[model samples]
Target chain A: MKILVTVAEVATVDDEFEIDGTEIADQYLNADLNEWDDYAIEEAVQLQEGGVADEVVTVTIGPEESEQTIRQALAKGADRAIRVWDESLEGVDLLDVRAKTEILKAVVAEEEPDLILSGVQTGDDSWMATGVSLAESLDFQWSAVVNDLDHDLEDGTASVRRELEGGVEELSEVDLPAVLTIQTGINEPRYASLRGIRQAQRKPLDAKTLDDIGVDAGVVDGSLELTDMYEPESESDATVWEGSAEETAGELAEMLREKGVTA
Target chain B: MTDVLAIADHRRGELRPVSYELATAGRELADETGGDLHLAVISGAVDEFGEKLAREGVDVVHTVADGEEFNHDVYVQAIEQLVDTIDPQYVLVPNSVNGLDYAPAVAGRLDLSIVTDVVDLAVDGDSLIATREMYGGKVETTTELDAGTALATIREGEWPEAEGTADASIEAFDAEIDEDAVGSTVTGFEEVAGGDVDISEADLLVSIGRGIEEEENLDLIRDLVDALDATLSSSRPIVDNGWLPANRQVGQSGKVVTPDVYIAIGISGAVQHVAGMKGSDTIVAINTDPNAPIMDIADYAIHDDLFDVVPALIEEFQ
Candidate 1:
């Protein structure tokens, strides 16, 4: 079996905002790996260790710097890596969920992986829906926030455990050739080994563009447009109450009531 | 006039509050866009559920009674069929687990633009602007959709419940689910047991984080909650350390709450946790660290040890 993991690099906001008292582009621009992507990579590695998959391939879409993140996943023991590089792909909102899903669908069509795992949501775009979107695009069985997965290759079925509200757990079984979005805390990610790090540098990495996947960036353009980006106002006035415990409690309750918080 | 479809999420024969809120939001959007509101219910014996939705300003309720329980494919097919029939200007769903699944699937199949966890929605001329949190709630970004039709999965409690009567006509729609579509089968469900109190539904919540320090100190906070008859919840770290169950965690990964009174005990208010409870009517933070993020959002801040502040609050409430 083969597993595919997709990661995206996102931007962070810095203190220096924009010219109009809004945070500037620099303030709005910090880049990092998808937090949940790490979990996806870790899960893939675990599957390989358990012999559920013979190899794990990591994929990412971003500018050139994103290769560093993919390499990190390689260091974490992904067998190979693929980077879909396009400078214009930066700052694209998740409104193109279908378009991205199509691109992923095309990748799956090419790679023909048995199982695909994704982070439940991305740090940059916490939409938490892309994995399912990709699943539907590929017409594959899928589960979201999956905490556990056990595969039965013979029956082409897999048992999955998902986290639900109120600490509830739901167990379901989906057929193979499925997609799953992994939640955090589902497993402990292993640190990069010295051997894995050295091996990652030598592993095969295929660089591709949207053209390679037969997708035009224009397909996603008309859906959503970034009219402008600005920083949110910091509306924090830290009011400190100083007094005895009883006094503070009385004051707190009164304040809440006055604010119409407590009836 | 276009039609807007709102998917209702129900489990164990009960509808979630977010389902009501999403319906209200959908109705408002439909009104603004000169569209009709259509509610879709998927489950076994969804007639009663469909009727309940009809009262909420929905022009029609579409029911898909194909399964004893939820199957992803069944829901996806039902929603996909609804979208095909309605050609809605907008599709609204709650950003819950079930919604998170089928909403995107429908969007993917229809090749529609989609937004998830949207907190605000408005029409700017012919386009729709959706405001969502970015960087774990550190910033808010608004995405403008130029597409003719857009799909959004709204965060629960973002919109107030609407008041208006509807014809509430219930329509049972055959989803034409196939045996292959129901390939995924639920083996069983294990409900987590502990507090009878549903914190999400609680109007008053007193939540503690790692700031409380020790497991034993939880008793003191419990006393304050008891005195005020307020529900007790906690941050992820508290739950992760086993001081509280995962159900009590108030954060992006846990339960999103908008209580009338949300008291933060020893919680520093990480963005993930704040995103869950910042919508509370009143926020009170008690922490020794004046610089904690929770203090920034608190209506009132007490810079004191929770150990001391809680006991006093319990006594005063009693």
Candidate 2:
């Protein structure tokens, strides 16, 4: 079995004053691998370690700098990495759902991997629909927010535990050659080691472009446009209940009751 | 005139409330777009449920009673047949497990622009503008569908359930589905434990998060829930740590809840967690940290240690 891991970079806020400031669109930039993507990579690594699969490949579509994010996945144990590098890809307002569907469709058509795994959602788009969209695009079965996975390579089926509401868990089996989106808290993602980082630097990385991937930018006209960004308004004269622990508790409880919170 | 079709979801021969909510939403959209509302029911012996749905301002209820259980291929084929016959302007489905599985296939086959987990939908001139949370719950983006026929899987609990006025006529439609197309078969069905609570139907919920500390502390929240007769739920962290079952989790990765009163105890309120419960009518957050994001949107906030506040609340309720 071969699993492909896709990663995307998102922006981080530097100052509270600029929480929603437009400057974040520019200055707050860096290619940090999404936290959930680590889960996907870790699952792939576990599959490889168990000798269940031949290899695990990491893919990312971003600027040249995104190669670092791909490298980060390699350090976490991806067998190889591929970067779809194109400067024109920056600020392309495509949600991960649409962008990943286009890219994964192209990649799946070429690789035809037994299974494709992705973080349930990316930090940037966080739509949590990419896996489903990619599955639809490729006409494959898709499972969302899988917290546990047990694959049978011989039978081409995977037993998965998915979280339901009210502390219930549901187990389902999906035939392989499917897409599974790994949810957070599925496992403790392993940290990159010096040895693994060094090994990652030596691994093969194939960089391609939109043209190479056969995704014409014209087809994906930015459906969602970002008009402007601004910081949230501040609250004035917010009451602070400060005192000893017991005193503060009493005051807080009185306030909550007054607000009809404890009724 | 164009029409809007909503697929009413049912499981184990019972109608889910979200199906009614989706029907209401579909009716509203259809009215705005000058179209008729069509409700589609797919299940065995669904005539009563189909009539129940027909009362909700729906022009027609198309019932397909073929299988004893839900088959993705069967649903896809049924939806395709309806779409082909009605040529609806928009297809609205609940963002539930069944809808998520089959809606995309219907969209793919019809080559329609698809949007999932839509929290807000509006008719914008000739297009449909669907608003969804991005970056978990940190950002909201509105996307306009250029395609004439758009398909959206609305997030559960975004719209109010419209009670049916009276019974209406039900139309039985035999969906054309080839047995050869049904590749996957449900060998069996295993019901998950604690499926009885139906957290989605609970009007009042008291949810706990990792801040509750340990599994034992859950008793305190449970006591409070008992006092209020509210359902008990948790964040993904507590469930992931095995402190609670997976069904109790409330978030993007778990169940999206929209209770009338949601009391969050010791939950720091990650964006993912908030996205699931933000639709609650009233939110009360209790956390030691005054800076917890959950407190930001909370209707009421207690900035005291939950250990102290929870026990006191439990005592008062008792």
Candidate 3:
């Protein structure tokens, strides 16, 4: 069995992200692997180590900086890494979701993996629908927010349990060649050791452009443009609780009722 | 015919509260476009669910009797076929676990412009402008579709529930679901980690975090919960430690809550945890760290220790 895991490289903004007119203050941002994709990478490695998959491949789409992130995945146990980046892919609000999905479809077509796993959503972009959209673009059945997963290679099915709102868990069974968006707490990601990191430097890491994936630059258009991003205005003024604990407690209760927060 | 299609979501025969919310939003769009608002419900038996959706603004309730619960294959197949028949300008679904499952497929298959987690909607000429939260709940963005059909999933709790009480007419439509095409079957829903409390419905939330320090200290927070008649919830740290059940956790990973008042104690607000409770009407934070992220958004903040402050809050309520 073959499994493909996709990860995103997110940036940690220093201070609050700022805006000078319509342009953003991009200098404060430093790219790192998205927090949510840790589970996807870990799940992929676990499936391989457990013999559920014969191979595990990691894919990412970002600038050249994302290669570092792919290597980190390699260090953790991915068999190989492929990154999609082009000069045209640079800047904010570009690289349309459908176009990105198409590029991924091309990769999937080339790899012909039986299973695909991705983070439920990225820390940035939060394009929450991309994983399912990718599945749709590929004409594959999918389940989102999956927490528990088990594969029956002989039966040609996968048991997936999803984490839903209000703490509700739903179990489902999907046939082979499916897409799943993994939620957190599925597995504990192993830290890359010195030996693993050294070995990762020698692993197979490839890069591709839109042309290489057979996608036209004309298709790369922003559906949602970034107008302006800045700090929101304060909700309201709040009186600080002062003096000793006992007196403040009394004041708190009175205020709760005053605000109609307590009946 | 080019109107709005709102999907009425239900689980185990009960209408999810967000169904009414979507109906309300759907009606607004229908009016703006000068077209009728149509609602869809797919289950093995749809009469009960269909009648519930027959509201004032709802011109028609499109029902498809297919399965007991939401199935991906059924939803995608049913909704895609429904769009072709109704010729809707906008497709509205709740940005929920089940809704997100099939919404993307519908949008991808149709090649429609999709905007998700929508909190607000407006019509500008032929484009539907959608307002949604970006970068956690810190920033709000309004998205304009550049395509013909708009596929969006609304963020629950941000909009008021639909109050249109008109008795809408029901219209049954076949999704033509082929069992062979269905790759998955939903079996059952189980409780995550055996927690019974539904925090989303709480009127007030008294949430704790790492500041409480240890498992033994949970009693102090519980005391406050009982005094104020508030629900006990926590951030991911406490849940990760097993100090509280996963259901008691409040964050992006747990549940999104919108209550009248949220009193966050010893909780340093991270982006993930803030997303779940930022819709709160009033926010009060108590922590020694005045620089904590939770303090910035708090309506009222007290810079103090949890052990000293929580006990006092309990006494004041008493």
* lDDT tens digits, residue span A134-202, model 2: 776787876766777875557877777765433345566677778888877787788899999999999
Model 3 lDDT tens row, B18-94? 88888889988988989989999988569888877887788899999988888988888899899999999999999
Clashing pairs in 2: A165-B247, A166-B247, A166-B248, A167-B245, A167-B246, A167-B247, A167-B248, A168-B246, A168-B247, A168-B248
Which candidate should be chosen as best, given TM-score against the real structure? 3
Segments in model 3 whose C-alpha atoms lie over 4 Å from true places: A21-23, A92-94, A151-154, A242-263, B193-206, B209-232, B237-243, B251-263, B266-283, B287-299, B303-318
Off by over 4 Å in 1: A14-24, A27-29, A87-95, A151-154, A220-222, A231-238, A241-263, B163-165, B193-233, B237-248, B251-297, B302-318
lDDT per residue, candidate 3, A1-263, as tens digits? 89999988876655456755433457866777876787888888888888889999988988777888888899999999889887777764634568778878989988998889999887655777888999888878788989889745557788999887666789989877888998776766688989889999999988999889887766667565555455556553566888777666667777798977453
Candidate 3, lDDT over the whole model: 0.81
Off-target runs (Cα >4 Å) in candidate 2 are: A11-31, A96-99, A161-171, A222-246, A253-263, B166-168, B187-233, B241-293, B296-299, B302-318
Ten residues in a row with the worst lDDT in model 2 chain A?
Answer: A14-23
The C-alpha interface RMSD of every prediction is: 5.7, 5.9, 4.9
Superior by lDDT: candidate 2 or candidate 3: 3
Q: Which pairs clash inside model 3? A: B56-B164, B56-B166
**Ranking of candidates on lDDT, top first:** 3, 1, 2
